[model samples]
Target chain A: MALISPSGRLRRTPFSDGVEAAGVKAYTVYNRMLLPTVFESVEADYHHLKKAVQIWDVSCERQVELRGPDATQLMQLLTPRPLAKMQVGQCYYVPIVDEAGGMLNDPVAVKLADDRWWISIADSDLLLWVKGVAYGRDLDVTIDEPDVSPLGVQGPLADDLMARVFGETVRDVRFFRFGRFDFQGRSLVVARSGYSKQGGFEIYLEGSDLGMPLWTALMEAGRDLDVRAGCPNLIERIEGGLLSYGNDMTRANTPFECGLDLLCKVGPEANCIGHSALQACAEEGPVQQIRAMEIAGDAVPGCDRLWPLFDDGRQVGHVSSAVWSPDYQTNVAVAMVRKDHWEPGTRLQVQTPVGKRGAVVREGFWA
Target chain B: MALISPSGRLRRTPFSDGVEAAGVKAYTVYNRMLLPTVFESVEADYHHLKKAVQIWDVSCERQVELRGPDATQLMQLLTPRPLAKMQVGQCYYVPIVDEAGGMLNDPVAVKLADDRWWISIADSDLLLWVKGVAYGRDLDVTIDEPDVSPLGVQGPLADDLMARVFGETVRDVRFFRFGRFDFQGRSLVVARSGYSKQGGFEIYLEGSDLGMPLWTALMEAGRDLDVRAGCPNLIERIEGGLLSYGNDMTRANTPFECGLDLLCKVGPEANCIGHSALQACAEEGPVQQIRAMEIAGDAVPGCDRLWPLFDDGRQVGHVSSAVWSPDYQTNVAVAMVRKDHWEPGTRLQVQTPVGKRGAVVREGFWA
Candidate 1:
C-alpha cells in the first residue's frame, strides 16, 4: 500500500498537539485536512468510545461562515430544506444539492442570526458551491471560511466531562442546538451535536490561540472520566448509519437516493437549485435508496472500493462503507440498494475485495 | 507518521493497478484522488526521471469540462486570462479568481473548440466554483467531470518513448498544444504538456477501461529504454520554481502575488470575475510576491507546514515548498515574500522545524 503524502494542502487542526500526544494511529483526508481516523486502533477506540469519554479533533468540520443580508437568501437557494423556521442557536442537518438534485454535501447549518449562518460542512468543497452561487446571482452575502474549529467531546460520559469544563449550564443544551459559553474569558459556541451517535458536545473553538489551552483544560477535567484523544470511529459511525459524504454519497447520488427525501421541501418556492428536479423525484421516489446491511463474514478487508451487491446475476446495489462492529459482532455496512432489494430482510450477495459474501438488509442501524 | 485510511473517496486512478504492480511507495491525495509522490524514493525517482523515461499517473489532475453555448462566456468569467485570443489547439495557463481577486485555481484551459474547454485543474476543487458561476448566472453551459485521466510520459527520453508508442506524428505536438492521436483505435487528446521541467506529453485517456492497456503498452515498448513508473517529484518541482496550489499558493493569494501577472488581463474589458479588483491590483501592485530561495542547510524536513521567514527581528515572508535537490545541491524553495524582501540576492533567515537557516533569494530556478 502507498503511504499518503504531507504538505500544507493537507491542513493541520488546532488540536494536533493533543492528538499526537495520544498517539493517533492513522488518518484520512477530509476536505483536504488531516482528520485522525484511529488511536489505539479502530476496534480499541470503538470500545473505549461507548464506555468512556473521548476528545475528538473534528476541526476538519470547518465552518463556512455566511454573513450579510443575503445570507439566508443564499442558504435557501442551496438546499430544499425550509429554513424560515430555523431559530438562532439551532443546528439543522441540511443536504445540499445541485440543479439536478444530486447531493453536493450533507452539512449542519448553524444559524447565528437571520443575517448570519455557518454551514459546518462534510467532506466535499461546498464552500466553493456556495461562493459560486453568491457570485453568480450578485447576491449581497459575504462568504468566507471562518477560523471556527469544532472540537468534539463524545461518549456516554461526554456531558459529565463537558460539565467539568463548560459548567453544568451545558446540560441544558438540547440536541442539534448551540449556546455561547465562556472558556478562558472567551465566549464560544458549544453545541449538543457530533458525528457519533454517542451522546456528546462539539465545542466551536473560535480562536486558534486558545486551542491548546482548551484542549489542556478538557484533558485535566476529564482525567477521572477517562477522557482520551479520539476521532470519528469507523465502526461506530457505520453502525449508526452516518453516511459519509464522499464515501456513502457524491455528486452522482441525489438526496432522495440517500434517503434524505424527508429533508427536501421540493416546490416552486423551495428556491434551491434542485427544486424542480427534486419535486419530480419526490413524487416518483428514488430508484435506489440508502440502507443498512449486515455482511456475513469474519473480518472483511477494509472497504476502499465499492462492493457491488448482486441478486443472482443482476447488480442490485453497492456497499460504500463497512466495518466489523465489535459490539454487534457483525460486519455492519451502508449501501444504496435497488427498490425491491431495499426491503428489510431481503437477501443479497456483496462482492468484497476478498470474495462474495451473503448480506441482508436491515430495517435500522445497530445501536 | 501515521497511515492514511483507505476508502473509495481516496479515489483510485485507472493506472492504480500498474502503479501498485510497479511498487508505488507513497501518494498524496489531490482532488480527492491518489497521486503518486514516490516510487523508489523521491530522490531515486528524481535521478531516474532526469536520466531515463518515466510514466506518471497524474490522473489526479482532474478535468472540469465545459460544454454548450455559454462555455466560452463562462470560461471568460472564471479567469483573468484573455480567452478571446486563445485558439482551438492551444492550452493556456489560466489563473481563476473570485470577485475580490482571490485565487480560486490555477488550471490549464484546454480549448477543444470555441464552445468547449477542459480546465485541467490543480489541487483544489475548481469544478464547484465553475459550476456555481454557471448556475448562479443561469448560463447555457453544462459543467461536468469527464472520465478523462492524464498519463504523463516524461524525462529526457520522453519523445523517444512516446514515438515508439504514438508514432512520429506525436513529435509535431508543440508545447502547450494538443492533437488527437489514435491509441488502440481510439482517438485520445495528446497534449505536449506535463507538470515537470523535463519535456513530456499528457495523453488524456477519455475512457477508463483502456487505462491498463495503455500503461502496459508504454511499459512493454520502453523496456530497453529503462522506462519506469514515476510521479511528479518534489525536488524537481521546487528546483523548477513550480508553485503547488495548496502549498505555495491558496485562495489567500492573487495571480499577481504568484507571478502569474503575465497570464492576467486585468481590466473592465477582461470580463473575468476578479476584473475590477485585479485591475486595481495591477495598478497598486501586490503587497507580497512569490520568490525562489536557496535554504542553506542539509535536506530540510518535508515542508508540510509553513516555515516563517524572518529578516533580523521582523517577519518577512513564508517558504511553502522546499526540498533537498540532489541536482541543485541545495535546499531549493518557493516562497511568498514581502515586497522589499522579494528582490533577487536578498538574504533572509528561515525558521525551519529543526532551527533557523540563512536563505538567499535566487534570480532564477535551478534547471
Candidate 2:
C-alpha cells in the first residue's frame, strides 16, 4: 500500500510493526528487533517439492490494473507483444521494455474483463513504470495496486489441491486463465500462473490480514489434499530455466538478448515505448543471445555479475545464472553467449573467482 | 551493519544504493505491501535441492555471541538447563525463557572456544536479552549481531561437496562440530550443522562481497558435486518434525510445554534466567505438550492457530501446525495438546475454521 503524503509523493505505507521485512516472531527477545524464523536447506527441499507439493506466500507479485479506453494501447506500449488479440480470461506472458529495448519487467497480463487488465509483474515497479508511460501518452487508465495478496499454491498436485479446496470450479480454469470466486465470503481471483513450471495457482486476496485467515482456511480445507507450508527453493527455479529479474537478468538486459524476440513486433501505426530501438534490434539481430549449458563437476554457478566464458583461450560470453540439478546430477546454467557459440552442444569454459570451470551447451528446460 | 548516530543511537548501515535495507528485495515485495518476493513463485525450489546440494543465504538467522567471564552465568539465567556438561565443538538446541517459564528464543548454542560461545539464534535479538539480564546480575558477557552472513551448503551430497570444495579437511569435522581453515587465502569457520536433517556444511562469512566469489569457487570446485540453488520450503521441514519457533511456539509457550524440558535443568547450583518458572512448571508438569498428529483427511493440515481439540464435546487441546505430506499422501501436523490427550493413538476432533477436523495422536517425528 502506497501512502499519498501531504506533498503528494507516493511513499510506502509503513506497517505498525515497522515494516516486518521478514515476519512476526512467535516471541520477542532482548528489545524485540529479532524473532525466530527457520530456513530450509536446499536438497531436502528439492526432493520434497518435485516429488510432492508445496505452498508459498508470493504476495509480492505486483498487479497493475489497466482499465480505460486506452488500456490496450498502454499495454501495447509497455510490452513487446501485442495484446490486441488477447481476450478476457486469458493471460499472456508479456515483456515490458524501455525505449532502448532494455527489459523492464516480465509480467503475466490477465484480461480480467473487457477493459480491466491485471498485470502480475516481476521485480520492477510496474505501477510506477505504467504511470510514467501513461503521462504524455494520453492513455485513459486507472492504475492502482489492488489489495491482493497472491498466495502461491504450487507443486505437481497444485491443480488437484486447488480443486479440493476452492471447489471443483478450479479444475475448469484453463492455463493462463483466471476466475473470480467467493471463499469464506471474500472475493478472490484465482489464476493458473506461478513461478514454478509445476502446475499451480496464484490466489489473489483483497487484504493483507486476509493472508493468515486464508492461509488457515486453505490448510483446513487442504487437510485431505496434503498441502504443506513451503517456500520456493532456488534449485528447481534455476534448473527449470526460469529467470529472476535481478538475479538472472536485470534492467540492463534487453528483451532480444533475454530470449524474448518472439515478443517484439514493430508494426506500422504502433507507437509503443522503445519502438524504434526494438525495431533496430530486430533488424540487426541481438548481439548476445541467452542460452543454457551443462557444466562439468558439482559447481554452483552464481549471478553476482556476468562471469567470463572462454573458447580456445578467447572470450566468448558470460554465464548469467547457473545451478547444479539434483535430478540430472549435473550443473546446468543459463548464459548470454556469442551468436556463433549459442548452438546447443557447444563446449566452453567459464571463469569464476575461484578458478575456471568447463561447460557444454544443453537444452534449457529440464522438464 | 550498525552505524552510530551523532547523538549516539545506533542506525543500520546504509547501502550504496541508498537503500537502508539492502538485499531486502530477495524477501519482500516493495509494491505488494503484503506479498513476498516475485521470484518465489516461478521457482519450485526444493525438488532440485533434494537430488543435489544447495547453498543458501540465510544471513537472516541472527547470532548472539556471549564472551564475558560471566557469560556462563547468563546462559544459566536464560535457560533452565545446566551447561556444565556441554563441551566445546558441540552444540545444544535449548530454549530461553522468561520468569513465567514462557518461551523466549530457541537457539542453537555452539561453544567455539573456551568461554567463547556462538549461539546461532532464530529470528530474535537475544543479544539484548542477554545484555539486559547481565546488567543487574552478577555476570559478564558481550552480546551482539556479528557482521557475518551464514551460508548453508545443504543436501545429501553436502558432505562430498564440502570435502571437494573445502578439501578433505572438512571430512574430519563431525556433525554439530565446527573448525576454522584457510581456503583460497581466506580463513573461515566451517560448521557441519544445517537445518535439513541431511548432511551439510555452514560457512559464516564476514562480508557480502565474498558472496559471489565464494559461491563461484564452490561451484567450480564442486563441478562433480551436484549443487543447486535452493531455499528451505516449509512443507518438508514440518513433515520432518522440525520445530519452528514462531509457528509452533512463542513467548507465551514454556519450555516445559514445547517439549524442551529435556534440555532444561533446575539444579540449585545453576542460576539461569527464568529458572523459578521452569522449576515450577517442571514440578507441576507441563499443562500442554507438543505432539505430532495424523489428520484424517487428504486435505493438507495448516497452521491455523490452535484448533481446539474436543473429545466427547469436551475441550481437550489444540492443534497448532499441520501440512499435507506428499511423501506420505496424508495430512500431518504438530500441535500443543493437553497432557491428557497427548497420548499416541488418542482420537480427537480438531475444530478448524471450516469445521471439526478429525485427528489422531501420533509420534513426534512424523517424517
Q: Which has the greatest TM-score?
A: 1
Q: Give the CA lDDT, 0 to 100, for residue B103 in model 2.
A: 74
Instruction: Please list the residue runs of candidate 2 whose C-alpha ends up more than 4 Å from where it truly belongs after superposition.
Output: A1-39, A301-303, B1-367
lDDT to native, each model: 0.91, 0.65
lDDT of 1 by residue, A241-305 (tens): 88899899999999999988789997666778888899999999899999999999898889888
| Docking model 2 quality class | incorrect
- The 10-residue segment of model 1 chain B with minimum total lDDT is B265-274
lDDT of 1 by residue, B103-165 (tens): 888888999998999999998888899999899899999999999999999998999999999
| Two-chain DockQ for model 2 | 0.01
TM match of model 1 to true structure: 0.99
Which one wins on lDDT? 1
In model 2, the Cα lDDT at residue B70 comes to: 68
